[model samples]
Target: MGLTAGVLAIDAGNSKTDVAVVAPDGTVLATARGEGFRPPAVGLDTAMAALAATVARALAAAGAPAVAHVSACLANADLPVEEQQLTEALETRGTTVEVRNDTFAVLRAGVTEPRGVAVVCGAGINCVGMHPDGRTARFPALGRISGDWGGGWALAEEALWYAARAQDGRGAPTALARALPAHFGLPDMPALIEALHLRRVPSSRRHELTPVLFATAADGDPVARAIVDRQADEVVTMATVALTRLGLLDERTPVLLGGSVLAAGHPRLVDRVRALLADRAPRAVPRIVTAAPVLGAALLGLDRLAAPPESHHRLRAHFGT
Candidate 1:
């Protein structure tokens, strides 16, 4: 087994996993991608096997048996206990390990420092905040039961609800009834509903409707627009709450936006988020985090190591941030 003073950095989201081996000098020696991390869906051992396989590939490519640290930003590690459990699960003989919510990866990937609030809207929505002093604020992010409301899947489901209701005379009229069905090459909402219910159209295909909803809204459909607006509201609401908890709302703090939905930068939603943030958290500096989140995992490891400023700069450069 080879030895190296480096970090095995991982960003494991609900959809996919990314691993990187970074040397102490901040050069990324290797990287690997694999299946998503979902311990709650698959058992813990199964999930670990998938992630460990990816990590092993990266380590082998980097010519290291292991590094001094394993920094994992994982999806579904919502609570501190979950993070601690994952840290212990990932621990190796010669390495220290830490695990944090995936949103924190988006946060650190955008910020120059360890302090910021980040709102991520992908398959689901989540928020997280951190201070340089190690204080953190986060949410349960356990879907509706956890009081969460925005995400691609949720948006698609909402659009379906509104469209179904509009078709059945149970709700106000909206173009979603037409646009949504048309997107799937169906004649109308009833046909779309039948197909979805019977699995003629895979349920996973529902995510495609999110963009259709946005397009309908852009065409001046009030119902669709309201849904989009509500999503923007949720994003800002979460960000504002996080910032306030971290005492950053009163200061000029960075609020990072990440994930597929936010990264798309839909003009209406983006504009609304900016306007709301301006009003509710006037000093909050909002920006989109487009960098690969594995950089943030690596940065967190370097932060633990007390690596120099130049190392951080070099790492950012490697990730093109």
Candidate 2:
């Protein structure tokens, strides 16, 4: 076995898993991608086995027998109990392991400093904030159960709901009445509903309609536009709350937006978010983070390792926007 000690970084979201081995000098040695993380549904043994497979592949590719640290940012780690369970589950793979909510990866990726707020709207939406003094603000982010409003899945479902209503005259007529059913190659809302109810259309694929919603909005559909606008409002609401909790609302705090939906840079969505922040938290600067979140996990590990600023800069340069 080769003797290269470095940080093992893992960013495990609901849809994908990214793992990387990075040297202390900021060199990324090896990287691997695998199926999304499975936990809370799948038992601990199954989850760890899947994760271990990816880690073994990365270490093998890097020719390293062991890493000094393991930093994993994972989805569904909402409650403190969940975090503790994940930490215990992941520690079996490395000498030192740390697990945090995946939104923390977004926060670390966008802000150069350790302090900032991040709202990640991917398959789901979550918000997190950190202060330099080590205090943090976060949400449960368990969908409607946790009072969360926006995410790709939720947005897509909302689009479908409105479109179905419009077709039946229960809601205002909109382009969605035609466009949404057509997206799935169906003739109309009734047909689409039948397909969904019969399980012919996979419910998991509903998130595909998120981009469709945006495209329809771009085409000047007021209903679709309203949905996009609501998403922006939700993003601001989460960010504003985080900043306020951390006492950074009036300060020059950096608000980072990450995840596929936000990072896609939808003009209507991004512009509205910017506009809302102007009134809600005027001093907050917004940034869309394009860097892969695994980099953030790696950076956090480097911080724990006490690597200097130069190392951080090097890693950033290697993964530059």
Candidate 3:
């Protein structure tokens, strides 16, 4: 686990994979991108094969015979047991490897030190926090089963529910009734609902309604606005809990907002999130993170290597952070 041969960093997501070879001096010698790494879908052997191809390409480009350590930030490594399983799988390559949930990548990418909370909300939602002492906080993030809510997919579903109810006289009126179907070129909520129910609209395209929901909220629709506000509240609630768990609530700490939903910076959601955090965790400095997660993986590898500040600086500069 020494840094004799330098570090290999991997950022593996559901749709894409990025890998890098970094010298001891923090010089990025080579990098590679490949297909998605989804062990659950393709099985461990298939996923590892895809990852190995990308790693081999990176190592070849770097002219490296081997790496001493592998730092992997992987999607689906939700629990500690999952990280351990991945670590054992990667160790077969004859390198010491450490696996962490991909949320850690977003968290580390946003902070100079591994001492911040990061909440990511793309198709799904997740949160992770790390204390400077190496303690970490995370959740199962298993959708509703894990008591999570307010991701893009969930928001879309919620919007449809309200719109349907309003159209059927079972709930309060909202512009979402018009906006949701309009997004799909439908005449009304009933038609939209029928299309979706019959698969004429395809379940895969449901995420397209999220922005329509946001737009409806921006137009002062009470139901849509409530949903948007609830999302913001959920984000802050998770951040507050993480900060409290790490004993960072009273201290000034970074709160990183990432993934598509937060990164979009919708005024209603983003502004409400800021306002709530200011009230609940006044010391937290909240901001959006745009750095590539792979950079965080590389920086983590360098951390394990105990590389100098110059190394960290060079790595960040190279990644244009």
Error of 1 at 207 (Å): 0.8
| lDDT per residue (tens digit) for residues 1-321 in model 2 | 596666999998887889989899888898999878868768767877888899899989998878889899998889899888888877765689888998998889887767999999988899999998889999999989889998899999999999999999899988987888899999999998998899899887788889999999999999999999999999999999999999999999999999999999999999999999999999999999988999899998898898988888988888883
lDDT by residue (1-321, candidate 3, tens digit) is 223348888999776899988887888999999998888889988998889999989888888868878999998888888889899988855367899988888888889888999999877889999998999989998789889998899999999999999999999988888889988899999999999999999998999999999988898888999999999999999999999999999999999998889999899999999999999999999999988888889888888888898999998888997
lDDT tens digits, residues 57-105, model 1? 8888888886898889999998888888888888882379888999888
Per-model lDDT: 0.92, 0.90, 0.89
What TM-score goes with each of the models? 0.98, 0.96, 0.94
Model 2 residue 147 CA deviation in Å: 0.7
Over 4 Å off in model 2, which ranges? Answer: none
Backbone clash tally (model 2): 0
Range of the 10 consecutive residues with the lowest summed lDDT in candidate 3: 1-10
Pairs clashing within candidate 3: none
